[model samples]
Target: MRYPANHVLGAQRNGVNHVSMNMGTVPPGGPVRGTNYPVYPDKLLDWYDSAGAGPMGMTSVRVMFTWEAVQAAANGPVPAPGANYANYWTDLVGVVTRCLARGMVVVLAPWQYNPASKNTDITYQGQPIQPAMFADFWAKLATAVNAATGNDQRVAFDLINEPHTDEESSLPGDIGISLDGWFTCAQAAITAIRSAGNANTVLVPGMTWTSAKAFTTNGSAAKWAALTDPLRNLGVTVHCYSGIDSPGSASPTVLPDACSALVQWARAAGAKVHVGEIAIDAGDNGFPPFGGTLALAQAQWANWQQFCLANDDVVIGWNWWGNSAAGWWNAGDSKHPQGHHWGLSLDDGATRTVYADLIAGSVRTPRLVLHDNLADPGTGENTTTSVAWESPDIWVRQWADGGVVAEPVQGGRSCTVYVRVTNRGTATWPATGTDVVTLHWAKASAGLSWPQPWGGADPALGGRIAADVPIPAPVAPGASTVLAIPWASPPNPLHYPDQDGHFCLLAAVTKAGQPWYDGFTGTNLNTNILRMSHVASRNIHVVPPGQNRFGSLVVENPHREPWRVALAFEPLDPWQQPLPSVQGRLVLRPPEHVLHRLRGMDNLTEAGPGRVALVEPGRGLQGLVLEPGERLAVPLEWEGEAAPALRAVAYDTETGPGTPTGGQTFVLGEVEGWTVEERAALV
Candidate 1:
């Protein structure tokens, strides 16, 4: 099985993105100091070896550099020993030599357009200029590198990283260039390289951040078609980011649409396409800053890899965006409170996440189709060869009295609706993480309108419930197992008509901790719902967890009655241990006639001795009256070594503690860091 001439799949070889990289005082910094954030070239190579990239069929490395780094002045003599560009040349050439030694194709990508950098300057010789000057700069550097390394055949050059139309006029210090100007400049650069006795491959890219959306709609086909490569060694590159279409919506479907179209356009233009930079925000990176689930991110990248493999002739390869700054992890900005995550391997260096694992899996298991469910087994159906966001086709089996049966019993009576699921796709159904069969309840609708996961639900019923029975250990390809939940219809009288009885029961395999809507296709959602025939009012209604500066908890109202209820909080450490006391420590001072205080903050009244007033309805005098569908909030202050769990309950002297409802058992603490203060700092 021979592949395309240069159709080798791989990743950005740089250990970290230059823009986010820690400079550590570059001019006077140590050789590899900045890259010490976690990795450098050697470390990255080690990761490749350990991750089995060679066996997985990956054969290239896209080395990134900046134009200014190589040729500070557009007309500066070829990169030499004592020039300002010396260290950059040395580092880049060392990477190329090392990659070539490993028999990997090297792609030299010099970025002339960078809006993220603090210094966004592109000049020629002594004056700021545009595309033509960029061509001159590349020509000089390409000539120098080729001469220095003997014009190695494995070497290729990516003209620029993610150029856009607006970039021409965005900068005031430089002359602007149109899209056609970029093509013309690229043509001149190629000619210069070939003219200087170098025939390395040249990679050209479309505008608009080199995006796929731009490739298809931004008159890219015409520009790409007009590009002239005398040596006939040319390729086009585009970036596919989920956020391109919507914020954090990178799914298995987005990339292929753009990739397929780009490949078609490239084939027409007598060139191949390479995904220059691809990234998606998996949920772990934090929602405010980045959206989407880790599973979706994995699926998107894997599908893109699969697409390249399926179309090896037209779509050459792709590179996971360069590793990001280590410091950014958990140092979330205004958008994401948990910090940022943009690296192949985490900052810790010890753990390579599912992203890396998926890349390796795609290489080793190229074109290994995995479907959630297939209509016909012998027919060998192939559904577009994309990643499975949600398994669509699940066979739901219902049984009665231990014998196999079809239809669930009707009428308002308690009956068993035993169910099990089978894996019909090419991919394995993971037993853990976000992949598991969960039971959810939704009001049944007329006709075939199944309930969407994000649709409305009664506040009485909490979030989707996990199966009472554990998912069978590793539901491999073509495997099936019973659900952990033993489905017993809620008990009711005959022909019950309330909302509870007029509902459908759903069993979905969702990415744990993420919304069910994350799946690419509806296949993961089995709409063959078990219709309910009974109705029963919830004795207690518990809402999802809410948080404050002190702690987090779930509130519940017992019986939905209009009676006022008094709530009490008894805080204990994670292990249910009492707060340790050091000779009645004075960590805080209470205002006169008040109970609790944290320095300049408002003072709080206590419920009693040793018990803080987390929630008081009327100056610690009256109870809160909660009506149906209404809830009350209790503010708590967590000042301890570990997160505390509170025994919280709405109380009524007539009903007693047993009758009152309890909040969520555990409350996570804000463990930012340790605090130590003087015992008597206040007068």
Candidate 2:
């Protein structure tokens, strides 16, 4: 299996569509602490215990354990009983233990290393707090937790929370920590854990100036690479906010540059990565419609979560900023007269719409789907053989563009076996217009190549086929048909580890049409022929009574590749002839209804193979793309009084010399006593 058993969370069948927010470090060690705001009666911990426990402790809590708490009591005697953690650490054990007894997972975060303030007495030996402090704190915390949760391995830890170079909001003129400082902190912390005989995994943040945070790659990378131990599987935690970027838009799906770049980089590293924090500063204050920050936040969160889902090999989770009430930005409780609030929740116990959305979307871990061996009874030579399938409740049907696509058009993705046979003996194995040479296989995914098995053909259904099939049909002298049909691929069952699997692929078919048109051809959608229920008929007319001056383009050579057609019109001179504008530029006649253009904008912009455009009939008329064996009737007419004559051309680009040419054209003559509505019908 290429993927590990736990990789279901990373199993991006299509991609991830939802993301989480870092709602306040869910009070790691304490009895119960809300955001920066005071917890309701400080007994909020009791409230959580009452709430349904999710997969983790007290609902699978992934809490933060601060270094500031672990390293306090500086130069003093180290104390006899030590810093009193009864309120913070001791109470936390109760939360974890109680939740564990109820079957919940507790994810721990060993917090940051805020180096000493540069100036002031905050300096340690003329330098900011050294790396030793991080290691010291981590070791102490690990020991405390190990002793605390004797039987529960669910008490795993994440290394730090947003480590960075600049220590903002520092005392005025205070020298802050550097990126190199972050490296030392990460390394020392890791070493300390292993030295203490523990194997808890810690997530590490990638080095660089990502988003509004300080600390660029220069120093962070230098310090990180120098680490002595191997830190291969540790996940990368990143922060992303959705404010400012989604301005003026509702349901904004934003993904900013910093977060996007990091996602890409982690992709290459093949390491686990996730957005640790994505916040919206506005708490539904209803600011200006085009609020730049708010817009950016929403868009980034939406796009980032999707990007993460697409790269599940490395990315499997995300957390938007703090929950509860205190917003992430205004933690100081400062007035927002100058700066805006960055928290997603309000102090009045009201929560932002995005708050609940993120938590519902947060990742606890991966879920998997496994099944095997679903095929047909026997194999034959060059004949249509339909296969059977049984799928995990959450199997996903994926496509070529990495989006949801149908089978048949999706090529090799629809079926695993290719049926090929030759008639060298001059004998027809199967008659024409019949399904022959059907290949059978099951569709499923496991770790890497060994994904859990999904759609396996059911043997009970006559050779494991969806519908009963007749005996081996014969093909004529020269005839063929492909047995491509619609098969179901569902997402992981609810509360299942593998909800990521979806649908994929959509496109043209390679098999040729048979003389006998059966339901499979255009009647039913089981096969790959995109047979639309109805097509737009040509509508053209001229001004006069009975004289028909308008014309239609007789579509020959039906389209094989994708197709899109937009009507074009040119202005009429006083002489009443269809001519390009004075500048010879053709006029674009926008369609009344929204047209679903096929994906190939690259060709629309530049000229190349498979490029499509409007074709011209005579003179300056343009051309368009129209594949052979397909039909599309085009309507054309001229506008004028006096029963004048003017030629209207219809064409597709690239179908000719990458220009418009060789198409049906028309000239509208005059009409007498025709109502304007009648004129509309004539033209």
Q: Estimate TM-scores for all models.
A: 0.46, 0.43
Locate the minimum summed-lDDT window of 10 residues in model 1. 530-539
**Whole-model lDDT for model 2 versus the true structure?**
0.34
Q: In model 2, what lDDT does residue 487 have?
A: 37
Residue-level lDDT for 324 in candidate 1: 38
Clashes of each: 16, 121
Worst 10 residues of 2 by lDDT: 445-454
lDDT by residue for model 2 (1-683), tens? 01232222222211111102222222333213333223222222232333422211123344544433433444222111332434445545565575455443455654332234322222323345567765766677777777778835555566655443445434444444556666666778788877877665555664432332221334442343355555333555555543443432333544444445554554444444545555554333323333344344445455545454344444545544443323333521234453333332333223234433333333322221111101111111111211011111111123323221112123223332112222211123333222222212221210000000112333211122132222133533222222333333222223222221212111111112211111122211111111110000011122234343343333333245643332234334433334453332222221221112322322222123332233332343223344533334333233323333233333344333222211221223232221111111111
In order, candidate lDDTs are: 0.45, 0.34
> After TM-score superposition, what is the CA distance of residue 417 in candidate 1 from its true location, in Å?
55
For 131-153, candidate 1 gives per-residue lDDT tens digits of: 55666676787777777678776
